[model samples]
Target: MQKPSIPKGTRDFGPAQVARRQHIFNVIRRTFESFGYAPLETPTLENLSVLTGKYGDEGDQLLFKVLNSGDFAKDVTAADLETGSKALLPKVAEKGLRYDLTVPFARYVAMNRGTLTFPFKRYQMQPVWRADRPQRGRYREFYQCDADVVGTDSLLCEAEIVLMMAQVLNGLGLDDFTIKINHRAILDDIHQAVGGVVGQEGSLYVAIDKLDKIGRDGVTQELLARGFSKSAIDRLFELLSVKGTYLEKIHALSEHIRLSIGTDYTGYTDLREVYDILQASGFKQFDRLEFDPTLARGLSYYTGCIFEVKINNVQMGSVSGGGRYDNLTGSFGLPGVSGVGFSFGVDRLYDCLEALDLFTSTAETPTRCLLTHFDAASGRAALPLLAELRAAGIPSELYPDASKLQKQFKYADAKGIPLVIIMGPEEAAAGVVKIKIMQTGVERVLPVGEVVAALTVE
Candidate 1:
């Protein structure tokens, strides 16, 4: 028989792995909830129309489309198939695994616009699927923990997002990551100043977004290949190379844009206002907050601020990122509703935590104590105690068979159960039980009624 196996870019998490992941999720969920965002959930399958066009062209290509259910290609003409997969895709696939949470959330808002409250704040923790090749810290399937606020254009939402990002990272014992911030308007002004073609802005962003992966020389070559003039590329680097503090960089970029394009620097003012808000709120993590002029989040719908996070000293891609979308809802016929949010790449974060040795010891199994018995009578006598232990809110389990003592002890040790109750024939006859501390091998003989309290204290 062929060996059973899971697909590449997917995983089956064991108990320990699940426990560790749950720890990360609990921290993020608590942080999101503390910020007054309620939980929300969306279906795994969304209409292809809803998933596509929100992300950029490259992102659309990464969508995992679901083939239509029966006779999917029955209506297809040979000419349609001959035209290629691109032209024939719509005829066969109508739904796709969601690429991200933001778009579906926008769709939900558009559909329920009449009943939903404005500025709907929600947090969603769910899995998303992409069709990209998988590598270390990059998976075809992963979880994105996202929190978004819609129906407002206020910069306060941006500031709060930064704060929440910091809180979530720090709460997860990640103190050395940088939160990079940029604005789409800033990128647009830079594009215009660099004499970029109007309709080819996506090409510029796609190139610039790879600055970290490919250095300046590589970006210049790419720009040239993409029809950007050398002088434009030179001007682009000059603007991006502005140095000094966040305020200093903002001022310098603002002045350069105002001089080059002869227009007001609204993006600069927005950045300055966000900075002032953080400063007023006594945000002390400025060192961790960076004003990255070259940070262009490649998502198409982002119209205002964009954010990305990277942990220092880790050889991995971004662990979290998101941005402000001014009119994502417009595509769904709910025009002018604005929203901002960020997503934590749970898989990458897990890899980071493992690399940093940040995960504390968590119980692999919820079973706190296992009841071991030598004979059928003792096993029968332990039933009431098992019920009592459970009634006392302690997780307890009983070995099903009249297993050997060593076998039962090994089972408890392997499962990381801290306590094991030995209700042997003698112990049961004496109306007492011996609780073994699995770690230290110390055993205590206690009355049947006191077992719960003893285990509870331990």
Candidate 2:
């Protein structure tokens, strides 16, 4: 017999855990709805073509490929054997588990472009799978609470997303976080400043994005391993240190850029435009917003401003991340339309809550009151009162078995049940009841209406 074990990087959430997770999802979903976003859901499995080549090379490798249902081995070809066609393997194995919400969302918009409204607002709460290593605050199977606005290039989308993120986290009772903002164009300007390569965007950004995880020294080591020059590295370092008001970074870059590239290109000036717009929109109060130049989300599709949110004093991975994609849907022949969105890593967030002890009190008592059934007849007698308590908006559970009174009381006590309404033979015959305070274990005989009025959380 095979030992019962799940694949690595996956998880199984028990009942209480599901409740807490659902609570979090409800907060997010409700907040998204309040912001005029409609809910959207995609299938768990999508055509491999739709998912492939969308999340950059690293992401493509992390997709969980599905095998063809019938006799895939026989479909092998001689030319396929020569080149080792991982890309073409999907033709044999035609479907894949979705890698992320954003890509599938792009596919959806493209397929439904005729029907979708411009600046189509959508909120999707679903489980996304990644075939990656499982570690602290990361998982193979977890939920990405994503809200996106597609078919618009307005940075107003950025501000609204920032506001949405602030609202969601604030509603979750987490006020301590920093939303680090950066622009791909600004990074592009810096990249152009030193040894610009046409297709090096993904490789460059992925390395820079690791700066937080690996530190400056680690980033330099990784870039060197990726073949960056000394002069290029120095210039990129100067580019990264750009901070303060957006104008300051642009000005500083303007001055030092020529040192490496021999011409100070005025590319990052547009970012200052973005900053001015945000500043005018009163964006400063938007949840500890900070200018971080190192935010390079590994997705290739992001074509503009990018942001990441991190909790202060918490040593976890990014709790949320995303940015703009100017032409993602264009890949499917829908040209020039743009979209921007962000994803909240719910699994990492639950860990953050646990690490900070924020959820210490979230393991709510299952029932506020337990309807104690004294015996077979009394159990039968107690059902109406149980129905009445529940009808009165009380969360009450009936102990189905007519167990020993001690055992029933112990069940109520073990569940942290604050109150237990007992219908014993004498009480049932007299049309009275015994309401015991499980916390204090004190019993009081009371009328039925009195029991309902008493259990209200005063």
Candidate 3:
């Protein structure tokens, strides 16, 4: 048999990695909760129809089609196959893995319209699949940390989302980040300023999304190659280079940037705005932010303000991106509702933390105290001690098999357990435990309280 292997664009996170990931998710979840957003989840698979046209043509092509269940090949024929994979799909395929959480959420809201209250706010943490060639930091299967508020067209929601982005980064101990802001209308403004090019309109947003990858020059060349006149490309650049604070826009496009999303007026000024809003309400600490005009997130669906977060020195793609989708619910038959939100790319953020050495020691290895199995009788005697450690709210585990002290210590050290509790014949008899500092190789005899206090001191 061929050697076993997993698919590309996927990963198997070990225990250590899972712990680190959990820490990151907890940070985002906590921040979202503080902002009054509730938690939600959408399924992994959605009807092929629900996903097809929502993400534009390029995104639609990246969808992973799920074949019809059991006896899938019963209807296949050679002639049908000869026409090509696309031609043969109807006989077997009916559903597809979700490309993103947003569309599925739209469907969810529509399905539960009457049962749910208006202006619903929910945050969803779930894995989404995209069938594209993966690269460093980008994966085919990854989790999306999304927070969306629907049922109102409030600029306050947009401003709050901006603040929420800053809060999560600041919470992650990431003080250095930029929240690039853009609006789809601003993109439309640029396109219109380019003298109303015909085919250029459709691909305008897609080309803009490549701003980070190709830079201005490359993007100009791409637009030209795609039938845009050099004049149109130059016009596009003119609009892109108009850099002023989002609050000081020179026109309607600029004014929209300044207007607080989900509100009638702009909130506060710059990155401190989030802090100002939260601090006034008893929350402090915030992250840095920048207003990058070319941040074209959710190109086709996002209707209003958009955002992207990036760690300053790290050389990876965005750690998060999202925007306002005004008519998303309408696509599912609920008209006139607007929502603004953002998503954290958890895996990319994890990789970024690793690269920057920001992931703490605890994040990497969470299990701290390991109770060694000294002997069968000693192991039985040590059970209560383990219970006490756990009762004190410590992540303590017992070595199931009674192994040699050295071997058990080695196992605990490998797993980065900071302290190893040794309860051998002598210690058990004496009602004492030998706490060994696995990192420092310092051993000391202590009572249960003392052991708890020692482990508690980080």
Best by lDDT: 1
Error of 3 at 425 (Å): 1.9
Number of backbone-clashing residue pairs for each candidate, in the order shown: 0, 0, 9
Best by TM-score: 1
| Worst 10 contiguous positions by lDDT, candidate 3 | 260-269
Q: Write the per-residue lDDT of candidate 2 for residues 1-458, one digit (tens) a residue.
A: 97899889888887567767777898888888987899999999998888888888888889998888888777687777776876358557889999899989999999998998798999898999999889988889989999999877777778777777878788777778988777787677678777768777667889998888888888888888888877778778877786665456557766666565555343355456556666786765533776677778888888888879998868888899999888898888888888999999999888877777776444346577888876778888888888888898988998978789899888876666788887888888788998888768688998876777777654
TM-score of 3: 0.87
List the lowest-lDDT window of 10 residues for candidate 2.
Answer: 262-271
Q: What residue pairs are clashing in model 1?
A: none
Off by over 4 Å in 2: 85-88, 243-251, 254-287, 364-366, 440-445, 450-458
Q: List the residue pairs that clash in candidate 2.
A: none
CA-lDDT, candidates in order: 0.92, 0.80, 0.78
Please, what are the lDDT tens digits per residue for candidate 3 over residues 31-114?
999989899887788889888889988998899999899998898999888998776877888899999888888899999998
Model 3 residue 6 lDDT score = 97
Q: Candidate 3: what lDDT?
A: 0.78
Note the residue pairs that clash in candidate 3: 154-261, 154-262, 155-260, 155-261, 155-262, 155-263, 156-261, 156-262, 156-263
Ranking by TM-score: 1, 2, 3
Please list the residue runs of candidate 3 whose C-alpha ends up more than 4 Å from where it truly belongs after superposition.
Answer: 73-87, 248-287, 363-366, 447-458
Q: Over the full model, what C-alpha lDDT does candidate 1 score relative to the true structure?
A: 0.92
